[model samples]
Target: MCGLRKVTLREPYPDSRPKMRGTVTGGADAPVRACDVRFGSADRPQFRLKTIQESALAGAFGQTVLKQGIEIRDGQGRPMDGSSSPTVAALRAKCADGPAVFIAEDRDPNSKHTFVRQIFASYVEAEAERLDCEPLHFRMATRM
Candidate 1:
């Protein structure tokens, strides 16, 4: 099954200056806010997947937010194919409970290497806390 492996956060883009601690700027497409959270390095490149809409995540926890639901996407920025893979199925099942934080190996479709994506529902932050890792909050610039 494709699962998430431990990963270290990417360093800030060379062009932009670092903002508040754990915050960086100028890495993602305009309008989408992103923050890089550092994780431990692994043999493969690992990525953290989060929804662009914070409200959707807040709503998942029963908090009031403008958005109502979460949308999961693949590395290619497409809707996930849950039915075709056990990894996706497990991820989907975990997400059903609430907002989820996933740590996954970034894969190239053209490559033959296989990897897994790990899903954590609320538990991720707790795990991070246990590991003494601070979760980085990146505020992506919104497109007008």
Candidate 2:
């Protein structure tokens, strides 16, 4: 019932000109190109666990285990625990084996539900895969 979708984050400027390909030097008023931004909900265990009750993947592996935020396990399926606040570096160290599943909360503050956003095959490609759904890629623009 779940599907992947493409999302774009844009930074708008009323007074800016588009830049040509390979033209590094442009007028100061040139519109800045956007940068791609990618991340998974499971990137932060605390937040993931905090919002677990409101997630659809509640019955994914084990409800009890998931409720406790122990989705990242070892080869034998033992929960890995450390800091309540985990960083990208911490996740990379824990997910050294392969992809890991984590639910991502929707950006909409008013939404009452969250979905399984990404399945990371590795730390480098944080949003590489998905669970019971299609893959989604997001293009985000930033100011230069």
Candidate 3:
């Protein structure tokens, strides 16, 4: 089982202090006060896609067509594309009719999976049923 505990410490050093209000694993942790350190996975050599047996690039992470051949556009009437992450309110305000695909995209440059692309492409392919029209990714894969 896992639980979170509140930890408050008083230190006479800085004007601002940080409390260790995080998950407890019953392990020793460095006493941090007003420390601005963010933990993240180390930059690993871009993993191999071959391991997953998938390689489909979005020649451009922009734009999808509706069933009626209408291109998905942002509130500005611009064709939705690029690494843009729009909010639900934005979509609701723009797409008044229907079929407002959220288009979840993970712009993580290190991850080795094209899961986002797969979802977007598969959805577009299934809904639009237009193979030739499915948009492509803008970036190129690593050189062989």
Instruction: Tell me which of candidates 1 and 3 scores higher on lDDT.
Output: 1
For residues 9-42, write the lDDT of model 1, one tens digit per residue. Answer: 2222223232212121343222123233222333
Off by over 4 Å in 1: 1-48, 51-55, 58-98, 103-107, 117-144
**In lDDT terms, how accurate is model 2?**
0.24
Encode model 3's per-residue lDDT on 14-131: one tens digit a residue: 2333222222233322111111111143343121110000112222212341122223443454554323221100111112122223232233464433433333332333322222
lDDT for model 1 comes to 0.27
Off by over 4 Å in 2: 1-68, 81-105, 110-144
lDDT digits (tens) for residues 1-144 of candidate 2: 011233221232112232212221343222221111223332322212111121223224343333332234434544432111111111112222232333322233332222122212221123233222223223111110
TM-score of each: 0.24, 0.21, 0.21
TM-score of 2: 0.21
Q: After superposition, how far is residue 139 of candidate 1 from its true place, in Å?
A: 30
Error of 1 at 11 (Å): 21
Worst 10 residues of 1 by lDDT: 81-90
Number of the top lDDT candidate: 1
